[model samples]
Target chain A: MRAAGGDGHPGPVIELNGLTKRHGGKVAVDDVSFTASPGRVTGFLGPNGAGKSSTLRVLLGLDVPDAGTALVGGRPYRKLRNPLRTVGSLLDGGGAHGSRSGRAHLTWLAVSNGIPRSRVEEVLDLVGLADVAGRRVSTYSLGTGRRLGLAAALLGDPEVLVLDEPVNGLDPEGIRWIRRFLRAYAAEGRTVLLSSHLMGETAGTADDLVVIDAGRVVARGTVPEVVGGHASLEDAFFALTEERGR
Target chain B: MSAVAAEWRKLLSLPSALVAIGLTLVAMPALGTSTARRLAAQLDAGGDGVLGTVTTLTVGFELVPFAVLGPVVLGVVIIGSEYTRGSKDSGGGRQITTSLTAVPGRGRLLLAKAVVLAGVSAALAVVVIPATIWLAQTALGEHGHTWDALGPRVAGAVVYWMLMPLIALAVTVVTRSGIVPMVFFVVNSSFVSVTHLLTRVTPLAAYLPDMAGTRMFTAQGPVHGGLVMLAWTAGLLAVAALVFTRRDA
Candidate 1:
């Protein structure tokens, strides 16, 4: 089994500092700032269009911010040499061509970052996708595709992981497996930042929470601190976001 | 170097690239042989038209231009596949996300892809050009010129093939889809030769990429034509790299 951080190096922190992004003329992420520290699962909680994805996109360098900085390990993602060795990301769907098999998809990604080909099979197995690795992605069900995306994210066994809506399409068992896997991952002193609209699931998995409404942070802290007298994280989430929505 | 290997594998793994290869291999030689046979038959019937001047090199030249479609399609597929969306059940993701995450330097990634596209196009030309010429010569039999006559013309054809795909790749990068470049190239190369027709309307039309590229093998000034085509390829590629690096994935 690969140890967390792969080579025994500690996980790196993900930091977004006053990051602002505009799509057309409207603000998509407005002066957003947060940190997902090493050795913790930071749940980025928001409603749909809450700018959670926009923040993550800037963090990964998939989209440019109009102002401010998003950094991983104290450097921008685009500046990292062999970035997959430092960070792994899951966005949207499988992030694979429909005509490519799951194995083929991982194979090219591995090759690109100079990751060993052996890791391809390892990730496939880790995600319980070894059986269908040869099947084209277009044929995969929603949950299966999510597994493939997770497998790609895990291919490098990197120090940090940034995932968007990771449990959105998962079944109950898959959700349970991911919760356990992520918790154990952070337990090994690695960093994980996952975005979700599902309050209960994030509450169960995240050690810290950063809640955004529209394009700004509404609340951020440990679950207990953010929940503060709200009875539950779910109730806290609704109250925080609903208050901002008004 | 690793990025190049990855891009190469990405291209080869696409079923559309393989299909394009298969069709090019078949179509080039088939077209060469048929053209050669028709010319020979016309010569035998004592009909002097273009057939009266037919030679082995000319027969190959007649068919080689059409082979441009092969590289054009391959070039478009190289970038088009990245933007292709998956089925709704698969979350409608695009491979560009995975690609950017793997190699976050957008300029580096686009350069690697262009290198692979150029290499594949050149390799395809090396294989298909010789095969088509050999088959055409065999079909021409006694009427054909010796293979020695093809030395420079064959080189010219290879260069022409190599450059055409880069042009296609650049256009596809800007458009972010294969449909426009594929239709524009395929129709102009095969159907009516829009560039060829445009030559009658203006002298400057002779300088258009495809029209100038064709002159590399078919005209006397191979160097001049090749340079013009190269300029077009380089300019478009520069614009594409700029747009690609500056745009969001």
Candidate 2:
């Protein structure tokens, strides 16, 4: 049996307690909450407009939540000095400008946070973009852009990784690499919170699940725990999201 | 300090910004000489020996309508360039998001930008002031002001060109596009007749940033021209700070 109280767990490194966000008259996230613990891959699954991006935005301090708190490392992300060195994040589309060269884009981000210039090259190599680093981002293919984004995310070598749809444009090889890399990253006692609708794909990687729909967490637990006697992870995901929480 | 340093690096790296700097440096001297000769001809026709006539340092104020164009573009380029593309939220392309995420302190980030703008403006002035003086003296020869007489004009010219664009920068913040301010500055600064007309209706229009900035060189300018320029800049910057902090990136 699993251990009970006094499990000595450090609790979650990423916490969203009673997070609520509204867009004018519309409610984006209605008091939804969850935690991403260390040394495990926590999958954030949802349908389109399910408030996945909104939650990530507030968590990263890109957008302020109307009510509730989103904290990283037990402190608001805004308070950290050179936050990239603490929580590396990869938002959708990599937040890149087409006119800026891939290397130059990373250079400014590195410079802004006072990260070493040499780290720029290191990340370029890490993301397998070393040869094309000098080319303008406009010419980059979607997969290439994703690799560049990943490179930027790894530039600070942060302990916690927050990624949104990171597997979107990757090929099978790229997806497998990410799966292996994220798993290995979690194995190193770091926190990995990945949001994607790919249930079966995430099944082999994530240690826990956070299924959200209609601006609330409908189901969240270990792989099978959320699956709960269902035929497969996807079946469980559909039940939790489409069926409006059984 | 790091944020400020990084902003400087970003300022230098921008290609459009480099073009603005190059244009201002080249055009100031190229146009200043021709302008001095024409103004010297005007002074002869007007029959006056005004101590600090616009022709005293032609490049400093006489042909300002055109000279101001380059620096004005440079100002607009500094802030508007960011909004040209990728400010959209569809992808992670909004530079503001990346910038604010890294800096977090909205006020400090904009202040760093302002400082970079000021530093670049001053550097350009360092080059433009001397070159324009030498060129104007050579072109206007006997018609030009002497060294002692030309001192304040040189100081005035630098401060004027450097501070003028900050007004445009603040406007760009509100418009969120450089195009609006760029067009407005180019058209407004190109022709003085419109300003003259506006000043007739409201004499205090003389205290506008452009006019107040010009006073740094003109004989008829008010005693508090610098303070007037400072007030406008401070007011606009306060607006930018308010809007930038309260809004969602």
TM-score of each: 0.96, 0.91
Model 1 lDDT, full chain set? 0.87
- Candidate 1 wrong stretches, greater than 4 Å: A1-12, B47-56
Which model scores highest in lDDT? 1
lDDT of 2 by residue, B1-249 (tens): 878887887767777777778887888787777777676676667745544533464444565545656666766776776565542323445566567667888788888888888877878876887787778777776677676877776777777777777777788888878888887887787754456567889988887777777777664453478778878888988898888777776
Off by over 4 Å in 2: A1-8, B37-54, B63-65, B87-92, B191-197
Error of 1 at B84 (Å): 0.9
Clashes of each: 0, 1
Q: Looking at model 2 chain A, which ten-residue stretch has the lowest summed lDDT?
A: A1-10
Residue-by-residue lDDT tens digits, candidate 1, A77-119: 9999888888988897778998889999999999999999999
Q: Is the docking of candidate 1 incorrect, acceptable, medium or high quality?
A: high
C-alpha positional error of residue A86 in candidate 2 after TM-score superposition, expressed in Å: 0.6
Tens digits of per-residue lDDT for model 2 on A1-246?
111111244768998999999999899998977888889899998887889988998898878899999999899988888988888888776666666788988898898888999999998987789999999777887788788888878888898999989998899999999999999999998999999978888888998888888888888878778888899988877766666642
Give the C-alpha lDDT of model 2. Answer: 0.78
